[model samples]
Target: MTMHNMKLKLTKVVAIVLLIVSHSVTANTGQPNILWLVIEDMSPLLPMYGDSTISTPNISQLANEGVVYNNAFSTSGVCAPSRAALATGLYPNSFGANNMRTSSNTAETGLPKYEAVPPVNTKMLSQLMREAGYYTTNNYKTDYQFKAPKTAWDENGIFAHWRNKPSNKPFFSIFNFTTTHESGLFEPYGIRKLEQRHYFSSDEKKIALLPNDHRIKTNEETTPVHIDKATRFPVPPYLPDTPTVQNDLWKVYNNLAETDKQIGAIVSALKNDGLLENTIIVFYSDHGGPMPRQKRLIYDSGLKVPLIIRFPKGYKAGTIDERLVSFVDFAPTTLAMAGISIPEYMHGHSFLDTSNERQYIYAAADRFDGFTDTIRAIRDNCYKYIRNYRPNEPYYLPVAYREKIPSMRELLRLQKDDALNKAQGQWFRKEKDDHELFNVCNDPHELSNLAYIENYKTKREEMGDALELWLADIKDDPLMKERQLIDKLWNGKTSQPTTEAPKIAVQNGKVTITSETKGAFISYRMKNDETSPHWQIYQKELPIKQGILEAIAHRPGYIESAPISLAIDAD
Candidate 1:
């Protein structure tokens, strides 16, 4: 036997002596099933939020049946960074995952493909659910600024569902609707790739159509159901109210109506399965709207989103929650609702836990697509303060991805001709204020800057000092260039290394495993005659059973080790 094998044997010998204490290990088995219906690139534009631009009866129904959160915000204005905070229950900047995205689509930008190196012992929220014996599924986007671990899900594809798990097992499933994504604002709306079209039948399509919409060109013969074109929308002061911009508004609301239909389908499925009463449903958007100055900025139009949580049997039905909540609170909140202990390493506190209700929520903006800028924001219930680290950089970065939208193109054309009105011309300013303070409660459009007002100087200084303290506490070095940050993540190496494989030893009726890599979290699955195959977070040595055992090891940001398996008999 090799030296590694010898070490494994010794570990196994020690484990068998303590095997009697392992049989009682189990998690909270009676927790209710959880469901998250996540939509992308949307704001609170429904009837519940006082926006009459569109009527979302399905979402409105959920709002009537659940608790609606009016002050929910994303840490970042963009999706990938917000998702990283949601997945790990930690601030993205705390672990170098704060950039818009770390890999893929970086060739033109000349940035290396690197993953955000979080702490070694960190595990994704799905893996935590799996360890607690809950069936987990995501249908499925894993843009967490790092590659997701193999042990994170039992099913992670378009067809992944709660029904795939064994009967009576509690489940945590996430369904992401791309119909409301920013890409919906691109031209040729009928040809734009939408998630709803993938599953809708021709009959369902006809039911979703609106009368006389601009999305359909003069060329197409077929018309599907969509939102009404005659509905007049209240345009924000930052954009023009021209025919072109109004057309984009129509498209946005039309896409939202389609998103509501998709949400209804998932709720219907739960009811059909007779699981509606036993499941806790959550509905929310990933971030804010998808327009110029909204999708990637630190303004409330970019970071604020709609959040609704319906407990089993509508425990808090028809109530509006006015407390401030951030994306960082999501992971710990999920764990708290499921009866799992929240880890101390998490930066967020559970609103359900009631120990640490927050008085403020913080947000930040960094590099986006091909351009880079650094801005941090702090918000109370009534006021918002923003500090620009690079004050000389223009507020508009000319991002290639955002310019694809029709309204953005219109703004650029109007700017070139000097035909834009005062409100429409705010975004094209040559320079930006270094510090900005706004009473968002009074100025919903955030048009007026109160930073330099003599009467508000004390308030401005207080918010600025609070922001500085937050940055120091989170250990975020926004001044560090992106390239240097990448080097730090990779430890000055050209590439990251994969985690070392674990060594497993099976002796007598117990199995013990250890990895050569320190701080690697070990997860294993054992097949018994009664239960389906599912990964479990290994706490102690596992007792041998009648079926098979498989194990893998991983650390955050490092590639997972190859799974090792063993067969055991009843003897």
Candidate 2:
């Protein structure tokens, strides 16, 4: 026989032995299933958080049955950057993902469309879970500043769910609710028809296929009004108390209520699946509230979000955790809960182990759409320190997208008319101080800047030093130009790079796969059929296969390589 035919015969025998070993391994490893019920652009506005402006029964139930984290904060005020931190357990600034919406508005910025390239060895949190034998699913928002690698999750589409996973395998599923997003505050608001999917059964046939637009664009008359128009709203000092503002607040509460109902549906699904007791349900927002000043600023109003973690068998139920938790902590904490070892490279500490609880949290605000600004902040339990790199720049950035909200337009109109009060007009200041400090407990609105005060001098210096240390530790240059940053990320390349295709080698009756690209992750399938098959992350050399082995490679920020196939015929 030829050398190739003899090698194939030997590999076929090895494959048979390996297949038996793989099937003998237990499918269920007794790992806890993790379900993240993520919401968009919300704050602690529910009754559990001391703001009873809106009743959110579903979320309240979660709080009652879970530990409510009173001081959970996002690393960034906006969703994309904050999500990047959550996905990788690293601050967005650490990997140049701090800029909001890095993949869009290239023409306006006069820059190339770029993705945030994380450190070479950094793997997404979901990818780590998949490596630990979890069936990961995201249903399905992935605004992580970079396209997720194919090995990141088992399923990552709108229809993705724990129900789709193998019956015996544990799952790590994420369901994002966008009903409470910033666009919900737009005029002529109607409920997003797509959100009705949350109310539908998980059965694919029963789920309605809807348009991808999750924004409310129809007339207000077409939607059900959950909040009374006559209801009084507690307007913050930054926003004027006007009928227009009040109407927007009504929409906020109405949308929040809708979000609660959607949460109820998801919780019911978990219980119905007979996995409620075996699952750990975590509910949190991507960032903070969606209003103009709240959505993109680095203040408590923008960064602080509600976090509730319901452990299996009601572990620590109804307990309140006031530890300073940042978005970066999500990944490590989830890994700890899954009985998986947290990677050494992750910047976040697992909050589940309270031995090393953080005393402070850091946040950043960078470019939002076409506008660019650099602001960094650090907060402890009571005081918050804000450092504005461009003190000459006005706090009010005229972002066109934010202008869609009626309250934002109202602020501009009031500003033009010079009708705003001292407190309401603080946001429109032409210039800011180089540094500002606030006693958040005394002044929750952050209206009173105490940086120049005599009594708080010591506190100011301490916070400033802390902020500096954090920035240096993270290797973040807040003043770097976006274009220069892009070049650095691409290693001075004029165009984006693609991951090198993975190569397969057969030696000693073992199949080994590798990629030439540095830090590239390899994913492969062992099927001869030229159809879409589940891609498995290659962790080690596989027992020789006889039919076909297909593999691909991907590194964050670089384009994924095309799949290469190797066919080995049996004798």
Candidate 3:
């Protein structure tokens, strides 16, 4: 028979075998149930992604039987933005969630001055699915741009899920499992642990199976909701190969394996409940694994995630659809699958509709590294373009850096050394790249930069224009109205904003600053100070200080403002 028919038959056979072997995943084909199993701080480390060192049996099994996108990426590099894009099918900046974290739009936080839009609008993918007559539920997690409003789900909680439903109703449920979050408190090794241990040999019988950062404290371990305390994470390659690193990586493998085990159990339970056959099960991660630079960044290791969609009946499983997929596309894709109309506001196209799927998947990143302001990247099937708006800013900002990850500190030290080496220098260097481009086909790791080369100028400009157009379409006029910076109040470790221009206000001897548009940061520095750098926002009880408070508000695509002057009476 034809190759296409043969592939379809093979898929059917596998589905049949799974039904027989596991005695689960059986149902009618006409109205299939939809299930989303989402993991946190994970990249595609499964065997399907070619990482032999770790055991991701369930995910690998899913990939083997489902369509896996080789070039999937998040629209934004950071968490809130990435999630915002994923849920809304729009770019993060367009949704006014351009920063790493955000305050929910409440009262003054909403509309007019600040877009009335909640960090995560209640009217999103899940809501759309529900409106399509599907019962929607969340597995208790909305760690996205903002809180998941009540209207977003019919039911949700840490222990309970909506998939625990009656078979008669077509259901759509999202399960966010937080077992791979890399946390500093989980470090069993204390501050200088990696420095103390060189290597930890494999001992499968060990108590923890993986020692983890050995830095994880019990109190911190209890918080399963946050990315930091979720699970024992794997250490990445950019760090030292110390015992700490080895143990950390091993723990990540162990934890991932356990997560997979749990996933199998959940699927098995679903089948037992007779939800398998008619169910379309999807497995993926929010961004990437919590291994060093993998999370909250635009690197492949950060943006690329494991994805598997399984349909025993109509989906034609074991078929690989390689068209580019971005997280932003998930919302529209879900609606399309549910037979719902695509919203005009969606910036992403559903991949399920060959006519609509993305020809070029877009990805970008703004400030996320605690106190750094960086705007970089674009990607399609072949090339990637990155423009660092703030090239002179510190590349290794302390805020986003993970202390428990062995690779980060190692890279930091290497950056200090004058000596140079090959295949290194990718981590912790002060000198920032102003612009970068790479042919991903030739360089999957994205180790090389082609942005400056004369030959690639045309391609870069094309991508740059495309990015601009997409961004312009998504800007939230209401949200962009309040132009103030998003920064930690007391910490010197506040991230940089996008631009310098916004209407300014200085009042009550205290500079009561507001933005012409809501920006990521509002930094202040003395006008005549020798250091041109800004002081991150640090104010609580304020009666303006005697020093001149020179301020600026910034966000992606927006320019920085001239300092708004503020003066306080001498104490």
Give a tens-digit lDDT track for model 1, residues 1-571. 7999757744543343223112211134556788999999988888898887777888998899889999999999899999999999988988888788777558756987778877767878988888887889888778999888767888787667787876756899998888778888788765554434325242231122122243455233553446667778778888888888898888788788878887888787777677777777889988899977788887999999999987756577899988899999999888766667667688887776333458778988887877888889999998999998888778888888888899999999988999988777877778889999999999876878999999999999999999889889888887898888888877787877677887878777678888887667777776554464556667678776767777888876877889987777758
Q: Write the per-residue lDDT of candidate 3 for residues 109-225, one digit (tens) a residue.
A: 342112213322225687677655567776656655544433355565543454444455578887665556565224542332311111212221111112224434434344222
Q: Say which candidate scores most in TM-score.
A: 2
| TM-scores for the candidates | 0.88, 0.92, 0.67
What clash pairs does model 1 have?
208-225, 208-226, 209-224, 209-225, 209-226, 210-225, 210-226
Candidate 2 local lDDT, 330-415, one digit each (tens): 99878877667677789887777555579899999989999899999999999999999999989999999899899999999999
CA error at residue 85 for candidate 3, angstroms: 1.8
Q: For each candidate in the order shown, give its overall lDDT on alpha carbons.
A: 0.79, 0.85, 0.58
Clashes of each: 7, 0, 51
The runs of at least 3 residues in candidate 3 whose Cα sits more than 4 Å from the true structure, single-residue gaps closed, are: 1-30, 104-122, 163-167, 184-186, 189-243, 355-357, 417-423, 476-571
Q: Candidate 2 has which clashing residue pairs, if any?
A: none
Question: In candidate 2, how many Å is residue 492 off?
Answer: 1.2
Q: Can you rank all candidates by TM-score, best first? A: 2, 1, 3
